[model samples]
Target: MNGGDVTEEAGEPVPESLWLATTSSTEYEPLPGDRRVDTAIVGGGIVGLTAAIRLKEAGHEVAVIETGRVVEGVTGHTTAKLTSQHGLRYDRLCSTFGREYARQYATANEAAIDAVERRVEEDGIECDFRRTEAYVYTESRSDGSDLLDETRAARRLGLPASYTETTPLPFDVEGAIRFDEQAEFHPRKYLLALAAAVDGDGSSVFETTRALDIDPGRQPRVTTDRGVVVADQVIVASHFPFFDRGGYFARVHPKRAYLLAVRISGEPPEGMFYSTATPPATIRGAPVDGERLLIVGGQGHEPGLDGPATSERYRRCEAFARERFEVESVEYRWSTHDLSPVDGVPFVGRLGPTTRNVYVGTGFDGWGMTGGIAAGTILADLIVNGSSPWADVFDPNRFTPAASAKALVEDNALVAARFLGDRIRTALAGSGTLPSPGEGTVVRQGGKPVAVSRGEDGELHAVSAVCPHMWCLVEWNDAERTWDCPCHGSRFDPDGTVRSGPALEDLTDRSG
Candidate 1:
């Protein structure tokens, strides 16, 4: 198997649990008849629901239109560690940007965590919210001096953080950084309660209602396949925003990370843990009725590149977990896609200076728990009050010299590499089917390039391989079962219907 194929190999298979099991939660029912709102939130995830709740409390008529059930997107698969400690980010941010910018980021995240706690208490949500220490360690072979530097920076910013060496890990470490009073919890449970609250007076969440198109005029109008939502403001919180304002697709990169939920027969680790070293490993667990459920996460890659190696990543994590705790069975296996910003901080305000009514909050870089909440607050404040101090820091319009330059070079390079690779494969195949069964690519045949896939039933399905977005080549993402564009981050189903996009057109299934 190629290096990409090894990602799917699981060392110890875990029995599946129904926790966050995703089904067709998209609301396909007809949109609400002739309804208008003060704000229309286009996503039902943490950012959207949180914005809806806040807007309602502000006495504004709010409506949330979701393509699927609330929280079923990236939020459901999060590590659920509510910590401001995002790897070794602070030191890098303070150095590359400025101490002031770094402090703003730290403060925003800390405030977000406090907001979550206050919301939990106010709503009386039974989401198992608990204060725990969060640690980022490195293996003996790796250097985590950056983490120590960040801990110091965090302390300087008045965050409850410090440096440490001791950990409950199985192996020895160089050093570890710890943030005290950080948290962990059941994200879906908390979000479900938030959804319920948002469904109250002045706010309503409509699931299965996908916003097909959005126009940012004096008043924003979101057009779904069935109907339309007319509102004064719009928030694009759909993981990766459907619209590509400020060139977000190029300003950030998309990564797919895997997770394994293992139920161990032994005692649990004391605190939440992660590693800064390459091929990162994150471990966190909680005791449910005396049984410890260890959630192991890591093995991030550029979405479709490591499809074959999916299982091996999980196996390596399972072995690491087994060494420390008696792992019983792997209870859940899933993955999530997150956008990593060029700089460490997320883009959390207006889409761009030109688009006044259009706002966005994305590029969390795997710190979704805290970042999502912060995004909601910043985006909502911009929409309602027209001014926020935090908006200037995260404004998509403010150009980052280092970040934007790095993003342009890095993201474009990946797309070019994939394009050339596809061309080489096509030339080698010549005039025949290149039966690379598990791979998805464009092969030249019958004087045309075709998208070919070997179905599970041993059948060949071929269609036009050209992406509906800018005619880029499409790569098959085995983990998410979708065809993804490497260039601009649009995704499509096997028979495409705009699964995700900057492209509005769906893939026409030519599998005849």
Candidate 2:
């Protein structure tokens, strides 16, 4: 999945995120001990770091605790398009929410673009931030009609959108909705600068410190593996909220998407392009030491992958790239998961009814760059000014109609079925032990299902197959060599340490 799958193989492994592989790594030490700050942020992604800098500027001491390196999670693995046009989303927002609500959504995201530019200029972050246009196009004539509708709706909402019949792609598109003044950047480089701004100045950034739970109040206490952070407020920016008293698990569910960065013969497309046709693909380019790399992304599916095999996802995107562009070698490939909100809008305010000082910014769907930065502004404003004009649309307590609510329920049903049904199936034929090499599966050992895998070095490793999040039977992801929980998207490394969480505890080791 997006954030959890982080282990490099012994040799000849699929490359990790191009952003992480190319950028300079950070050096924030883990939380040393008890810390007292004005706010304690739980994740080190774009949303958390953005909020941290904003809070520190408002004279608030903030401490950001991360389970691993900052920006190396979901934020690093993204396509990195910093645009407000999220695949014809404005039309749906107007229909589901209304014109006014859609306007607020557009305003927050469009303003976030300017905010990022201002920070890059003021802080002098060399993140390859560039101005570009973003387009969502279709290859089919019928889908082009939908593009026209989106163009009109976006114009009504004051977005810089236009309908066009042409683009910079090598192939022809029936039509497209183009948004002007949108931008793309090196997300890790940009966030590292913000991370630097948050640290020092009496504020701190603590990496490799996992927050187990939060005791919320006016002076909220964040209990991490290292120590406790007592702060005036707690911000739950963790991609999947570890503490789920707000029932965020139900409201936001994870969907995994794959990306491949490949070298092309000629200069890549100059603008951000997303094809909304069959086998949807998002194409962009990144500068790597003067040569440009074409980024082909977007084959989103539920984490359980109840559909096609996971290995097929990477091939599909690569096929799309090779079909339209000049052939070269695929450089890097990785996958990521995002928590999509049942309602279109993300939750970006008070976390729950009882916890007033505890805040959250989650469920950006698959478009986090702008939504995440906008969350920082809304969250910071709520902490500093008591309210924000855009808070109503993203409030955690908004009403959910039964119709819109069914998507989440259906997603959960699949997860539940996978959990329960897999366990029963494993019980029927659980005699298999370890796979040959670079493979894993669940097998019966000592009356329990054990996740067994053999490394390329002929070494054996084993861990309990049960997931700690809700006792679901974990499935082996051969592509990542990790165990993924279908129930809630928590993932674990081969040796059983959590790579991602909703489950703070590791799997019970059975290797010995």
Candidate 3:
């Protein structure tokens, strides 16, 4: 669902990302009955769109089926930083995998940035792309050594990295690593331009078309709500793969983070700054309606974490922004979900070991802008040439058991605990009470958990709380007014329609 369509119980508009609010919406018709294409892309975010463009350019017929509007998914909700400076990544990558693999990761991301810039220039896409330095700094004395080590690791790999004592942030810092020639842009605008380019030459982009299943065969078929897209290859770029035959749920952990765009009283930051401190903060500037606003983000936690409510996350971000910068007004606030792989590297190749034709790209770990583009390029090459030089690094089927074993166990354990714990708690709690307007809760009804939410109009809406993806109890996201799965990050509208997936089906309505 679009941000403009979501509202709170008081009938006040829920805060939207500055990107979504500022950009004009574009509409595309859903897939008309059954269709056939050489490739079927299941998502319309940056990854899917870029893959569509690349595949179509390679002379393959492509179709993009999006459950919602193109580019309005996680891509539209991102900080839109096109840098490879994911927090403390290089050091870990070097230690875990090796220096060469880390270098390849860095190279892939650097190439992704260049690819985006090259496309914008060649296509004349007016997406307000701008080049700026990226900084990862720390205020803590303990993190200083980490920052320096990261700089060393990055620079040794030929990345444009240097350790510095200063940053564009208004506050002081102990140390920071600066990566030059990084960039940022309006992601929706760029994707829209690409979507337009993909809408011809026997290729098409479809909105509001949900992919239900993928049938593996010599020629894969993607089953959807309206029809099936029979294609020689399928790419599951839908943030979380809809068809989880490869058991991606066990490999990826989803974290939710908040963002706030505020008008600062003084000059905005000149560069992108990300802090390595606790409760990490990322600061960047966005030109909006002739004035540059400071976008402050980062207060991440797994969904359904017991401590703070969803609104509290935004409030924390707002507080950080106002305290650090002389904020004038908070223009926008939003949250985005990121999928982090057990290992630092993203999974961007064939969906499974034997499933050569079906591909997937995920586990961006909050660096989707670059990761997604890199995935697009890699997937495009794999689909066309049947191989990519980067395939060994990003192979979705490759198992680094020693490195990822602990994470895989821990993440799945948390999921199992949440799943069983929520069910028991709700069973003991029992249902019957109706929450007030703008409130939601899970309670037992006839020995089953029911999700009950009251809207602004005082209408009670109820649905089964179990997520169709993996039977994890869906938690109420008051900020977004949706049921969010804690296990795999599937989200559904209050009325139970699927908003994001891995869960292709709607929550069963049990209000009656």
Candidate 4:
């Protein structure tokens, strides 16, 4: 599609989240030369900032290193449902890892909600924080049994779960797993406050400072673009651990999803709604100018696996919204990717086996809203008190063959296939036409793969197609106007700068 076509379809020149556009951003400079702190947290998203705040409460000096603005990473682009009901998770967790694991998972997330509430109340943070019921509903009768099972599992795990056929939705649902006293919030507003709290008082928040590597030892050193941050401990919370010593790239798979904020003709549903359908749809209302605007999200797929179809996810979400609600206009559109663990749980705590003073949190499985905050307390407990009740539950070193073996094997196999298979097709697809405005593609240049694109203004740009993270061929994400590495979900701007996802470094500039 051309630039005009993309604008007409996606409602903007580039996809922007509703939270980002509505909030004011920070002006913190990059790491000013070498720094020293008690703890240096990498990545300025929810997990890093939350952990930084908790450590500060324990009187620890901290510094945060961010590739971009704080809270503008995965934490800024979430569905923002703060609940223990993680999309029918307990049933699968119980079946896979047993009730004990499920209970701890439930407890951490439930307490995550309370943690956010307590912080908001204590700090007087006006982040549009409000309690709402969270639902995982199914529209198909055939899915009711599974939904009922999930409800039973959640309730048994002490989540306030209720099974219901009727809902406050505009359309009908066969059944749903409902949890009471859950919440929806302006995540950026809340975390921005935490970021502010994390700054000053011998603590620091550094933006535009990307952590390139971590040297974990007596004093863990986080090497960054500007300088190094030497600290007593370190936390890698950059969504997809930029430094993957734990082989997280294998245990966790990448899934890309789209989101759109639209104004409806009438009132939206008064709670968070997630459907249990394939590629599961999510609906939640946000306050907009004294009224409410419905945010429709879904149409998920593995990165690079879908090829040219990646751009069509936004259209799919638009169609879903129009078919159900009276979408007056799609006000905002954005896309975000999450790391899904092969197992049901997230990997938190130590960065790897036999590692000390280095912690990592990733594989949130698209529930970073709660998981990120929970990870903060978990990491804080591990750092200050040496252990937490959730230590073993989310231990990065803890591996269960039954829970993770199949997925771990499948994920790596797909990666290996892509690494080989993409190259196999590259030579044939090279010499194709230069991408139209707002589009990009990988082509053969001098017998090597080159990622090339044209801007909205018709200016051409090029970069080496190989991803710095794992050497997987990069693919064009037309909707987001970025090059996405299918293997690790590392995204880069048209100019080759790392936009988000893994890959701590940018794509190689291929200027002639």
Candidate 5:
């Protein structure tokens, strides 16, 4: 879910995820006082909610504690594409990994989609759930042949994927692969409806309850700011689990991607689109009261560092949309962040052997919707019964031999480079004053370091320059107008309210 509505200017379009615009709305009060349950699921996105619902159905008492409003994390901001095609993953999975493992991954995704269709039909969710053919196309000259390998691998895995030389897209593609029976939906709508459905009986959702940490053991304890939720099992469904026991911080890196919802005059094509190129564009359309919205996304990077180039990508996508369809207005614009595992598959299962009862789901690789649902099902099976056929595949304990080694060395080297580079830059600029206003700048004020932002309104806001979580200097995000810590991914509002965490406290007011 995109974090709850932050302050936006009047007459200016607010930044809301595409899923938020499409999902149904409701007013849900935050959780009050202490609570204990058979299961406590942290994070209120699709994964957490799905796990809570399944646990409740299995006759376990459940409570979902969310730091912000439900469906406001990455899920709400997603392109909301639910497909098994993750950009030529089949060929790589079969080659780098193994054929059987690749097949299992494909089968799990298919099962996830089927499960969602069944739930949507049985529960009658009004979230615009629809099945559409999904495509992965590329214009890159040398790599067009990879599509053929992907098609063969997919066929070997018993998937309904095929290679296609032609598509409805205006641009010419050397090649593309089509995956049948993939899906798309209004994510926030599905999540909120799921919350309402789970509200009765054994399950409930608690918003505005921040989880501080966990005390793990045979019966793990989840610690929240308000109170504790001691349970037989605890699922950390937060986009990145608050607890970093599984070395997830090193295993997966956080990346940001932008999305724009455009009103199109032409009828939307019958299929969903993705590309096999860097800074790729993923496009699809949804009907809203006789009109169609062209949802385009895909300039991804490490959150705050993309610089001016990121905004240009969004503009380029807008131009592409206009070239294809009569551009109506840009209805919504937002960005989302996700944790992508180094090995390209999600880490879903027990957090670690030492803490058997604690489960986590992360590193979706842009396939969160399907991966998250499958994760919930796997976790539910683990908690309720004992074993699942899919356990070993997604097990956190299973290590990737070469992938893990390269990830550890390369990620650490990158982090060190960033840390040292920031220090050098700060030292060279003696005063630490920023180059301009309306940009995030670190400056020394009255012998103290501070973070300063000059808003579009010309009002200046200042806070402690040091990040609350790790003391890294915070950078200004021009697009979102927030302070982002380049080191640990903690984010704060322009006025210093905590957005994403590891930083439980707000940035201290420097003006005072």
Candidate 6:
């Protein structure tokens, strides 16, 4: 395949998302020097860009600092389903957080959909935005009852939901919970417009500027690699808060999922659909040029856990697509990582009780489109009006020990066990021979675990295997060719550059 071909090739040379591949690239200069603004937004994804636009609209000077290009992170890689139907969530929310909180979750998500639609209209962003119905269905008879309960719960909470025995899917589902007037769009296109709107009027967007730390004070200072952003308030909108003072490492668990965009021979389904079954599947249609592509996703697992190879996950999605739909060719393949909150809801306000000036929005699980928008609105309201109606529910400091106790214990225990176990393995294995070209492995070097990779050109590259986030050993990801932290999902390049964070620093190079 040519380098520009959207289709998958033998070596998976183009790991770009469909949205990113189709959209035009835009770049912004890095932060020049120490600057001042009313708010400093770290990260330029859906949440940070939206928050910057909202804050600028509220007449506040805002600056958005991004380590990479805007919207190129998880936002660009998402399936872009703008629906409240998050895999039988209403029933669980009602059971776990009560009906009122469930109602708020529904309301907030619905409002977020409205906000996106309104923005597209008001800003004239031709991002292929469209309103469609969304369904959560299951093939298992036992899980059908949960769908029924969720339908009832959603309707009780005033959501536009209904229960049906049939759906637009090719397969016959046991039943489905359908939400009407939901939406989908090209996330990168929409977010790029938002990033554009965030510029001008005393506000700015800076790319390739990584934020190092937040100097908390009366005026919080966001220290960046190039300069500093002194502001009255700061929003940690990075997918995982880079500054981890709020203990987000324990509150959220990261999972990676694969997505494949394939040209289908048959007519694509009209509605967005998600499965409630184990090893969940999500199906939706995306219009690329004049053609509609079937976007099939979902084969989630913790990053760096060696099971089936990552390429195997993409193959699984392709196999599923071929089984259900008449697949012609896979147009694109990509992977994204999301943070799942222990409490089943995102944290979207102040970082903590004491850290009032710094706020964070994280743990959207796999439903960041609506969650990110809602978080941006909540953060904007809090920064401007000093409060929001939904503040208490999404407060980062709000403790619901009973709500997340099991998850908290289980997740952190896994982290601790993995950390100690990886160290023990490295210690026992001792130094070994270097990997062949186009491969990576961890070996003991100088009594320390060293991550070594041989590039395609046959040059050896080595770095410390220990993650800067919490000192957990990072395992090499064969599919993405990066070192992914099993603990908090921090990823680094083969030569030790930071790819994603919770870890602000690059891996220590030990190649020499």
Model 5 segments more than 4 A misplaced: 1-14, 22-26, 304-310, 323-325, 430-437, 445-449
Q: Tens digit of lDDT per residue, candidate 3, span 1-512? A: 00121121222223898889988888899999999999999999999999999999999999999988998889999999999888888888888878777888899999989998999999999887999999998878888888888999999888999999988788888999999999999999999999999998799999989998889889999999989999999999999888887889889989888988877787798999888766678889999888898888788878765757887667677667666777777778889898989887899998987776799999999999999999999999988898877777788887777678888888888877887888777978757577889888998888788999999999999999999888989998888888899888989999999888888889999978
Q: What TM-score does structure 2 among the candidates reach?
A: 0.95
* Candidate 4 deviation (Cα RMSD): 2.8
Q: How do the residues 1-512 of candidate 5 rate in per-residue lDDT, one tens digit apiece?
A: 11122122213334777666655555555666667689989888888988888888889889898898888878888887888888788877776567777777888888888888888999998788899999998777677678888899898999889988888877687888999989988777777878997776756788888998898887788888888888888999988777878877677767777888877566677789988877677888976666777887677766534355444555655666665556667787888777778777788889877888899988887888888888888889888988766767678878777556787677766666666666555555555444355676767777666778887777788898677765677777776878877665778998899998767789999867
Candidates' C-alpha lDDT:
0.74, 0.85, 0.87, 0.86, 0.78, 0.87
Every model's TM-score? 0.89, 0.95, 0.96, 0.96, 0.93, 0.96
Candidate 5, pairs of clashing residues: 1-71, 1-72, 1-73, 1-76, 2-72
The per-residue C-alpha lDDT of model 4 at residue 459 equals: 96
Clashing pairs in 4: none
Tens-digit lDDT track for model 4 on 1-512?
Answer: 11112223434423689899889889998899998899999989989999999999999999989888998887788888898887878888988888998889999999999999998898899989999999889877898888878888888888899988888999877888779999999999999999999999899999988888888777789999899889999999888888878988788888888889988898898899988788899899998668788998898778766343655777778778877877778888888888888886899999987568899988899998899998988999899999899777899998788888888888888888878878887978856699899988889989989999999999999999999888899988877788888887888899999887578678888878
Better of 4 and 5 by lDDT: 4
User: Which is the winner by lDDT between candidate 1 and candidate 2?
Assistant: 2
Model 1, 1-512: lDDT tens per residue?
A: 01122222345443332247522233324456556889989888888888888888888888888875778778877888899888878777777677788788888888888898998898788888889889988765447656667788888878888777888876677889888989988888888887877785757888777787888899889998658889988899887777766777667777767777877666568789988756678888854554667888777777535344544555556666666566667777777678887776788888878778888888898897888888888887877788766666677777778656776687778767766765665567654544355545557766656666665556666666677666776766554556777655677766566666555677766666
Candidate 3 clashes between residue pairs 3 or more apart in a chain or in different chains: none
Task: Give the Å shift of residue 274 in candidate 6.
Answer: 1.0
Error (Å) of candidate 2 at residue 193 is 0.7
